[model samples]
Target: MPEHDDAKADAKATGAVTPQGSGRASKRPARSAPAFGAFVRKEPVRAPVRENTQANTPVGASTAQADGLRVETAQSWPADAVEVGAVIEAYGLKGALKIAPHAQGGKALLAARRWWLLKGREQPERHSAVRASAKVHGDSIVGQLAGLTDRDTALLLRGARVYVSRADFPAPEADEYYWVDLIGLDVANEAGVELGKVADLIDNGAQSVLRIEYPETGKDGKPTTGERLIPFVGVFVKTVDLAAKRIVVDWEADY
Candidate 1:
């Protein structure tokens, strides 16, 4: 989950925002994001899903068509939805929302539209449904919704999470992978020595690193778990086979 402790911090402290499948979690010192794609806020929210873009529409007069029959259907959050970001503040005088994404060193939230507003970890199910029509600002994203207008309404959303169904994520290009996709694969070395399974990953400014966790049986014959912080760069990582659920690296178990 994204750090909610700083959710109420001023906008000036807004740093690099996370993008879906584009960034990892932060476990080390992370650098600010470079200037990525920024656009003016005037477009629609829904990015065409390769699977079914129109299938998961929201209910509203916004979707109502001419002759008053129908248009799009509003979608609720999926059970396995992944928490992507949090509401930072309202942008402009409109219903635009400012978000701090959880994908460390990434800008994945910029591509998200349909979002569920959860009031922190205590609020299990979503409390509200809103569509996002946003643009990338400095290090965060500013967006707007149909019913959500003015700073007062935005205030009600502070610290609320943004989630997209796991199935809603777009397929990555070749060689690129989603952080969620690599979460559970096994890790090994060049010589076929088993290391551990992927517990998590982090963004250390320069690149993404893998946090592989496994059981280590020490010389005392006692078992202890350990974590390996392997750089996800070309120098350390070799092949990542999602189909095989394994990553073959140029690293050693002892290292």
Candidate 2:
């Protein structure tokens, strides 16, 4: 992160405003619009699977069940290789299953040609015995695993999670970042003063704000107190260096 001196120099060179004092203030003002293509908010629907469900339940669990579904576990890739999506319910006797993806983009699930199906883990030996795979069908996706040739077979897979590796997805463009990448980056002001780590990104329908976990430090190098919120807008953000894992802002320490 750039220090206070560096920030002051940059502001002077660029003719931008610099906040005085600790910059801590009563409240932060509203931010302006965002630049095109910038990831201002996290995906609203998709998230990690929760624990404490039925024993052996798949990672990405769902309740939409039809008939002809089959379940089994995968073994070829590491845990992170595939993220879990909703399970397949039988579509019809011909052996089709309905799939609900976690993200709006189904590219990750579509790219992975194979899948391991498992029933809940209560019967690990039996769950491990099943195997299945799928293929992309135009906009929607379809899967056909071993022994799942009929509606009855497909119905058996209901509630099973669909997993795919992070590598299966395409890379993001410059200035555009995935919500997962920004979650823990350190946030600081242009003056090189420490603020806080990004606790999370909150969406307010209009825009997103960074929930900073403020640090407790005074001029005496002692802990002061309190936290703050900073809008992740281009006007306030000077630069975001993903490689360095830091965000330099035009904000002041006070407010």
Candidate 3:
């Protein structure tokens, strides 16, 4: 061993080249990915949730454990979901959500059991919701969402837009129509004189008013640059046919 050491030292001292490549085993530990089921936290549901409430907690395992409850991190939003309202804030400590309705009467907001909550104006149908116990709370509506049992989670959903499928709308009463059904319907007067088309509806404290836009110039060659706010009272609006895409009113085109 001494003679071998001496020989190695002599070889190094003589500037002899050593071999580079060899059969050396690597000692590093192999890397691995986490299992899919390890993600869920077993937090107890805070409230006595309704049996119909079905929401997933983003985690995969908890979804399967919840049985009848739904679990989804992503979804393909339905095409028929009509935008109606938005979430402003969480109502109280019990996980209720406060909503700002798009329409004045909020008939479309109150009509549906399912809602699609989009984080922004972009992709809204991806994460829809199953809602319950919706009612008017001052100027806004307050409601409950499944899996949102805590106030913190509700607060996080401050700017989420609300959309409800037209398929789930409550059947309209005889002679009554939803505000969405009235939009874009052409308006004409008693003498069959075409007034204009329904541009939009404005809500006063007492009732809703229809805003009509004229096609041709009235007295001004550049069209009526005035706001035609016609009251949608029982006396003014005579007939509304969504299928026919027309509305007959007791209004005058000149006036």
Candidate 4:
């Protein structure tokens, strides 16, 4: 969710936070958080995109436009980059892009000054500096990427996923955490009974819930697996030790 100046090590932790692996972060004192905001949860919604008449264009244009919005290609990707949202389509005539931020409401995107746009998982990513960006329609964001002018170029960016370096994200308030920071941490009960690792989080309109998966021995003494859903409330989640890579809760394994 945030970072300090330990440069290289922080970069590795950024890439490791993706779904396939886990990352370790320094521990912070556990405190009672009464409310949560952008770091908590945001549901995805369809953005209202305006149609444009410009034709398709490629990302490798060499010339800079008169207004100084240059389409410069990045030579390398930032190690701290993390996917945040995707461009839906062109909005208006002056190169504005309609974006559908990920489940977290583009909190990181809103805070970032630059963005990396990827066409696909295998393709190389391109970089764009932000000229202006704002949240629109409650769940979506409309942004103007520097050097990207005209509706045609904006159309070419449709479906391009947007990424921002984790270091660029704003720090969460005490007792609050970004969902990305909680995923993959081990969860256990007060009595130290292993429950599972956090696989994902769910927003049930009222609050966030932890989705944990773990292995167990069935009544027949055979190995089995099960999922547990625990509300991420202070009453249940007692302590979160990111340095120790575990969470202590009041929940029971059977529950």
Highest TM-score against the true fold, candidate: 4
How well is each residue in 1-255 modelled by candidate 1, as lDDT tens digits?
122223225422222322223233556544343222111111122322334323222223332221121222234446757666777665776656777666532234544446655553542324444454655555566666556655555654555667666665544444556777788899999899999998876765545677899998788999988889876654456678889999888688877
Candidate 4, 139-187: lDDT as tens digits: 4667777666777667767777787787888675555567777889999
For model 3 the local lDDT of residue 103 reads 49
RMSD to the true structure for each prediction, in A, is 12.5, 13.4, 31.2, 9.7
lDDT for each candidate structure = 0.55, 0.49, 0.55, 0.64
Give TM per candidate: 0.66, 0.50, 0.63, 0.71
* Candidate with more favorable, higher TM-score: 2 or 4: 4
Q: Decide which is better by lDDT, 3 or 4.
A: 4
Off by over 4 Å in 3: 1-75, 103-107, 122-126, 218-227
The TM-score, computed over Cα atoms with residue i paired to residue i, of candidate 3 is 0.63
User: What residue runs in model 4 are displaced by over 4 Å at the alpha carbon?
Assistant: 1-58, 61-75, 122-125, 217-224
Global lDDT for candidate 4? 0.64
Worst 10 residues of 4 by lDDT: 15-24
Alpha-carbon shift of residue 195 in model 4 (angstroms):
1.1
| Residue-wise C-alpha lDDT for candidate 3, range 157-198, written one tens digit per residue | 566677778787655544445566677888988899988787
lDDT of model 1 at position 17 = 22
Instruction: Indicate whether candidate 1 or candidate 4 has the larger lDDT.
Output: 4
Rank by TM-score, highest first.
4, 1, 3, 2
